[model samples]
Target: MNDSSADSFSPRLLRQAQEGGYRLINAVSLKEQLERGSIFLVDVRDRADYEAGHIPGAICYPLPLTIQARLFKRWWLKKLLCNEGCTNVVFYCQDVNSLRSDSAARAAVISGFPDVYNYPGGLEDWVSRGLALETGPCCEPEHHL
Candidate 1:
C-alpha cells in the first residue's frame, strides 16, 4: 500500500489482497449471470468511461477511493455497503490488464460480500463480443469508502 501522498498501485499488495477471495470471470460467464437472478455488477472505472458505455446493470464505484484496498494505504472494508449485495457480486473495469477490478473484488470480499467475481475483460470484452450496453445513466454510487 502506498501512502495517501502517493496514488500508485502496488502489484504485491494487490496480490496479497486477492488471495483466495477473488474469482476470475470471463465475458461469457458474466453475461450468463447478467441474464439471470440477483447479481450486483460494479464498474470500477472512471465515471466518464462508464458513461461512454458500460455493462448493463453495473453501478459505478469509480476507483482508488472505493477500495482503499491499502493499494492506497487505507483498505477500508468497513465503509463498503456489503449487505446491499445480491446473491453474487462482480467487479470490473477496462480490460484484462487493469488492476481496478482486482482491487474492487478484494474490497468486496473484505467487506464480507460472498461470491465475489472479478471480470478481467470488463466492458471491452462485453462490447467486443457483440453484447449490448445501456448508453445512458443507469445507476451511481450513493456511498463510498
Candidate 2:
C-alpha cells in the first residue's frame, strides 16, 4: 500500500479532510470500528465492483451517483451520518489511492458531517489483511442512481 504523501491526490484529500477536522482511518483501525459497530461504512466503488465483493456490512453508495445527485444526495448522506446511534461515517473504494473514496469523504465533510472518515486502505487492504467480504448485492438492490 502506498503512503499518502504531500504531493499525491490522496494526501491532498487527506489534508483537506484534516483541515475540516475529519479523520482518516487506516485498515487496522477500520477493522476495529467494524467490530465495534454503530459506524456507517460506505463503499464508494461502482455497483458491479461493490456486488463482486466488499467489506462486510458496507453500504454501496457509488461515488458517481453521489456526484450526479450532489445536492439532494449530499443532504441524504448527511442524514445517514446523523442516524441515531451512528458514531462515524466512513467511505472507501478499491484502493488507498482511489479518488472516488476521497471525493466521497470530502463531500460528506462538506455536507456537515462532523465524524466523517476516509479509509485509505480500502477493500484491497481489507482483503490483504484476511478480512472477510460480502458478495452479491448490497442491502439496496438499485445501487446505481
Candidate 3:
C-alpha cells in the first residue's frame, strides 16, 4: 500500500462527510442494498486492494481520482454516476473509518447525488462478518480508468 500523510481516517472527517449528506451504512445494510440491486457500489481503495478482494459487484474508483474528479472535474464525475440509472450511489473502503471512502462519499454528494451512502463498516467489517467477497479485476474498467 502506498502510504501518504493524507491516507488517514479521522473522526472529524467522518463527521464532515456525514454533514455533507453521506449516510452511514453498516455491513448488513450494505448487503441488503446489494441484494436489492439498482445501487451503484463504489470501492474507493487502491487497485491492488480492490483486485485482491472486494464486496461482490463493487467497481474500483480509487480515492485519489474520486477526490480529483470531485474537486476539479465535477461534471464528468457527476455525469458518470448519475447517468448509471442507479437509485443510489454507495462508497466503501478497506476500513470503516477510512477517510478515503468518506471523502469519496462527500464528493458524491457534492456532485449532486441525492442518494449517496458511505459504508463505513467497510471491507474489514464485511469480512469480519463472514460476508463473501469476490476477487479479480473490476468488471467495469471504464469507471476506474
Best prediction by lDDT: 2
Which of candidates 2 and 3 is the stronger one according to TM-score?
3
Instruction: Give the least accurate 10-residue stretch of model 2, judged by summed lDDT.
Output: 1-10
Model 2: residues >4 Å from true position, as ranges? 1-13, 65-68, 80-85, 141-145
Give TM per candidate: 0.72, 0.76, 0.77
Q: Where does candidate 3 stray beyond 4 Å? A: 1-14, 65-70, 73-75, 82-84, 139-145
lDDT of 1 at 65: 51
Tens digits of per-residue lDDT for model 2 on 16-63? Answer: 667756677777667777787857899979889999999988988776
- Model 2, position 77: C-alpha lDDT score: 66
The lDDT of each candidate is: 0.66, 0.73, 0.71
| TM-score of model number 3 | 0.77
Off by over 4 Å in 1: 1-20, 65-85
Which model scores highest in TM-score?
Answer: 3
On residues 11-99, what C-alpha lDDT tens digit does candidate 3 reach at each position? 66556654877666666667877887857898888888999999998987766655455464344556665564555788889885567
Q: Rank the candidates by lDDT, best first.
A: 2, 3, 1
lDDT of 1 by residue, 1-145 (tens): 0011111324543354458476666676677777874577888888888888888888877776543334542144324434443547788899877877777777677666667777776788788999999766635535453
